[model samples]
Structure formats: structure tokens, C-alpha cells
Target chain A: MVEKDVIVNSDAGIHARPAMMIVREAMKYPCEVMLIKDSVEADAKSIMSVLGLAIISGSKLTIRAHGEGETELVDFLINLIEKDFRV
Target chain B: MRKLTVRYFIEGEGRIDLQLRLYAGEGGLDKEIKYGEINRPGLALAGFFDYFAYDRIQIFGQGETAFMNQLSYEQKMKTYSDFFSYDLLCCIFTHDYVPDKLFLEFAEKKNVPIFLSKRGTTRFITLFVHVIDEIFAEQVTLHATLVDVFGVGVLLTGKSGVGKSETALELIERGHRLVADDMVIVKKIDESLLMGAGSEILKHHIEIRGIGIVNVREIFGIRSVRNRKRIEMVILLEEWDSAKEYDRLGLDDKKYSILDIEVPYITVPVRPGRNIPVIIETAALNQRLKKIGINSARELDEKIKKWIMTEGQK
Candidate 1:
């Protein structure tokens, strides 16, 4: 398993558009991805689970992935967040 | 777990049940209630602060109220000052007994909230303890679906797309009830029972992959939804593994621990042809039968052992 913590720097936080982008990016990988905030883990591949986190600006979240391509998946997700979901 | 504030306790359902009306100390509404026990300041009023449980919520019943009425004006003033010296959480006046103006003044000066209850001393304490216990209970939120199957609360858990919500939807169509979907808040009550409920924002809403967010209550009606249920069993739906062994005899008991309470756990492997909902319904019924002292697997083993022994004797 691989995990990386990133702070949400977007001005608007993770609303429907950003959450959908995260979920879409996560579903491309075969490994299991999860987003954890404050001890509650949400599936990164599920939009509902990601939105349920209610993550706002300046929120610290851990991007975690397990199984095949775990490290790359985590790095890819952290890069996405760092870029403010630009891609 | 979050801190329990004085304002939250008063705003909860216990407010109406206990007839709690705030008398003073509006500034202290944000004060934290650190303990669940209730304390009566009968001894504190007598000018003895030794071993005083000052942090607990103080209750002034008929005995303490009558005692204060008999004290001299100077003594009453002294007693009020002495009582409010400690960093008390709050105080309650029971049986419709209102505190004197001096007492409220002291409480307000100390920024300690004071509440009045119409219930008798004993009744108020019993109900207050019950409500406070729930507030301080250990809680955790899980990414799972909780459904009521045949009067048994079964928590469905697995990976994201492992059919947890789909199975719950089928169970609801088969005359069961849905408690929560996607996120279930499970609280350990009284150290023995685990109560599962839906989150305030996602209550009774199921998000099917293709169907988007659907209101279960609107589609399934009122009988198909419940606000909360005691979690009795946990079912984990996983993709069928070709090499892994599954429990076929139901002999070895599997347990899933949530908040330190162990509940019966079963792993159901999902496949194309298997009927997951019916299996869950049967599991719930089997749990109820076990609760009533009937162990089908053990009973069958015992019967078979007796028959083999008689045949060997013959």
C-alpha cells in the first residue's frame, strides 16, 4: 500500500466538479484507491463517497492506494490535487 | 468523537423530554460537559468542599432547595459564592423548583449555565443519565450500507463497487428496510450494543452506480426505511475468489468488531448467478433463531453422532 497526504489549495475546495474529476482519475487505475480525512476513509473511485468527506479549502487529505501500481496511483492523485485538478 | 457542549445538550430531544429551560448564564452555553455522571451539591451547600465532584452537572432537588430557604440571608450569600467557586459544568433545579435570585446571580457571575426541569429529582436524573450516556458513547463512521432484514440490523460492507448498495436495494425491494447508505454512523451504547444510524445529510439515500442518487423512502415508501437500528450482524460482500476457502458448515463463528463490540460476521462471495439478497435474509433469520437458543448446525452434528454410535453398537 502507498499513501500521500496533500492539502486542498483550491479556492473553492472540492465541490461536485473536482470530486468527479478525482473519481474519474481514480477509476482509471486497477488498484483500490481511498481518500481519508479525519480518520474517515472514502473510496476515491466513488463520487458519493468522495463528496461525503465534505472536504473544504485547507483540508488535509491522504490519498491511499493498494494492490498493483499502488505508488504510481498515489503519485498521480497527489499531482492532480497539487495542480488543482487542472487536467 | 466530538466534544459535547452545553448548548447541544439543551437543543437535543432531551430538552423537551426533561422540560429543561435555561434560567441564566447564556454566555456559558458553549461550556464543555466532560462527564456523564450527575452530582447533587447537598454536602457542598453545608460548607464542605471535600471530595466534591464539582465537574459533574450539579442537581438541586427538594432537599437542597428547602435547605437553602432556611439559611440566613448572609449565609445564603456565602453559600452561593462558595458553591460557584469551582469550575462547575452546569446545574439543574428539579420538580419545578426555581432557584433564588441570588443563586442565579452567582451562576451568571461564574458563567455557569443553570437549567430548570419540571420532573422530580429521581425521574430527572434517570432520564438525564440516559441521554448523557448516548451523547458520550463511542462513535465511528464507516463507508458501508446498513439495512434492516427481517427485524435484524445487518451492516453490509465491502469494497466500493462490490454490490453493497445493490444488495441493499434488493433487500428493500424484498420487504426489508434501509437505515443508511454509503456512510453509516455506528455508536456503541452502554458498552454492549451497537446502534447504527444514517448521517444527517445522507439519511435514507442510496447512490446506485447508474441510477445516481435515489431517495429510498420515496421509492420504497415509509415501511421500507428506519431511522436507526441495533446492528446485530455484519455481512461482507466480496468478489468470488477461486482459491480462497469459504465457510460451508457454518460451524466456526466469525466476528466483526466495531467500537470494541464483536458482532456475528459473515462473508458472502458475489458471483453472476448467486442471489445475494435472499442469502442475507436467511442469514438474518438464522441469527434470530440462534438468539432463541436453537443452534441448527450443532444440533445436526449431535443427532448424527448419536445415530452413528447406535449403529456401531448394533
Candidate 2:
């Protein structure tokens, strides 16, 4: 498994639209994806789960991926979160 | 879903047999009832059809029938013709009142179905509206598991094989009620409220990865399952990743918009040794506390800020 911690840079945090974007990306890879916030964790591949974390502009999040394309999945999520999931 | 026809309201599956008998305009039984609301067309009957909502089913109570009886035959014909000029879905006369000749003639001429109910206006309205609401409410299917935790509706959502059903099973074992599993039909009952229910075939049935399908109501008894619930919050379970920085303070009052209404939301990572069911339970209770204006994190932040002020003064 591969993991990386990134800070959310979006002003609105991971709201519905951004959460859906992340889930869309997460589903592209065939790896198991998860996100952690403090003691809580969520499925990165589920829009509802991603929004559940309520990751705000300054909030930090850990993205983890397992199975085949774990490294690529982790890198993509980190970049996505850092870029505020633009569009 | 689209609006239901008048005939379907009486003969459809889950139909409410309110003993509604047709008095006139039987040919208009196929007319569609768009809104679930009933209207008393007193104004329209009094020759004021300016704001007449033709889409609604008119209710002619005793007051309306008596008023019609007081009018002369020619006057009543004019009133009925003018009223029926607008395309109404139907007209229902309460208290089993028979339609007058002019009313029946106008109903037949205008192709507006007329129904008679034995129940009073208030009782029949209540029952008819209740049935109509069920048929006409806006609905959308969601891939999620819904459970009731401490009377708060908690919807568990995640990708395939993300342990959503497993977490729901644990919650069910802990004395919570399971509203739906796998496929939840979320209905927008009002502007700010959403209600969720399972498909009839999948009601109370949860599918675990290896265990196949398990019936929650059968295993956990009737108290463990409910037909539907008002969704209050959503908890998403995901695999654990060491590199992501999860929300530690929870100061962000996050919301998930479903059917335009925002609901409280949380994400719990799924990993070995993490008790997700307990976290969901606590999350539900915390939501309740927030509803009552008890925010622990905000209160603590204020307390810390006050402490710092006193320390600096010293």
C-alpha cells in the first residue's frame, strides 16, 4: 500500500461537486483507495464518503491506496487534493 | 416519477380503496393527477375561475353542494359550464353526496371525472392526500446503505466492496434499525427534507461480500428493520491510508447535499482495529448534540481563547 498526506487548498472544502470529482478519479484505477482525517477515515472512491470527511481549505487529509496501482493512485489523489480538485 | 392517473389511484398496486364511487365523467378516469393537493372550488363555482388551478382535483364538500342546490337551474348550468371550462383532473364530492343534474351534465360535457366518497371531507382528504403523496413524490435511486442510529438516519455510502454493508450489519447488531440496504430510493418529500426506503425486493436485505444476502429483519427481529426513514446524515467508510491527513478538529461544519437539502456528513476510514460501527454511533449522537446547539469543538475553542486572554493579562 502507498499513502500520502496533503492539505486541502480549496476555499469551499470538499463539497458535493469536488467530492464527485475525486470519486470519479478514484474509480478510474483498479486499486483500493481510502482517505484518513484525524482518527476518522473514508472511501476515496465514494463521493458520499469523500464528502463525509468534510475536508476544508486548511484541513489535512491522508490518501492511501493498495493493490496493483497503489503508487499512481496515491500520487494522483495528492495532486488532486493539492490542486483543489479543479473541475 | 410522473403524475398518477385517477384510475390508478383506485386500482393500482398499493391502491387506497377509499370507497370512491364515480358519479359522473367516467370517461375521464384516465386524467392525470399531478399534485397531491386537493382544492375546494367554491370560488370557481361562484363564477370566479380566474385563478382556478385546473390541475388539482376539486373537492365538493357539503357546503359546496348546498350552495349549488340554492342556485337556479340556469344559474347552476352557467356556473358548472364556466367551472368545467377549465381542464380539471377530477372532482370528488365528499359525504357521498350525489351530483346534481347540471353538475353531472357539465362534468360529462367537460370530460372531467367526478367521484363520490362516503367519508367526510376532512377524513377523505387526509386519506386521499396521503395516498397521492406516496405516488407523486420525486424519487431517485442511490447506491447506499441506510440505517437508523439513535433515531438519526445514517446513510453509509462507498464504492463496491468497501465494507458498507458490513458496517451496517454491525450497526444493526448494536440495536439500530436498518432502513435499506444496497439500493435506497431517496424521495424528496419537501423542500428541505428527504426520505429513503429500500426497493420492495431488497427491503431489509443486506449483501455481505462472502455471506451472500442476509435478511436483517429475519435475523434481528422486526425492531431491527424499518420501512423508511428521514435521512439526517451520511457516513462514508473508506480504506485507511497513512499518508492522508484526516480532519482532526472537526471544526468544519460539513454538509452533503442530497435532493438540494444539506445533511450532516462524516467519513470514517476502514482499517484493521478501527471500530467503524462505534464511530458511526458516536457521529450520530454528536449530530444530535449539534442539533440541540451543543457544539463541543466550538465551545472548547472559545474556552481556550478565554484562557489565553486571562494568561496574557496575568
State the lDDT of candidate 1 residue by residue for B50-159, as single tens digits. 99999898999999999999999899989988888898888899987888889888888999998888899999998987777777788888888999999999999998
lDDT of 1 at B288: 92
Question: Could you give me the TM-score of model 1 versus the true structure?
Answer: 0.93
Candidate 2, residue A40: Cα displacement in angstroms equals: 31
- Residue B155 of candidate 1: its Cα lDDT? 96
Clashes of each: 0, 19
Deviation from native of the Cα of residue A82 in model 2, angstroms: 44
Best by TM-score: 1
Residue-wise C-alpha lDDT for candidate 2, range A19-55, written one tens digit per residue: 7678778878888888887645566765445554567
**Candidate 2 displacement at residue B37 in angstroms:** 4.4
Candidate 1 runs further than 4 Å off: B12-18
Residue B225 lDDT in model 1?
Answer: 99
Runs in model 2 with CA error above 4 Å?
A: A1-87, B16-24, B105-111, B118-134, B311-313
lDDT of 1: 0.88
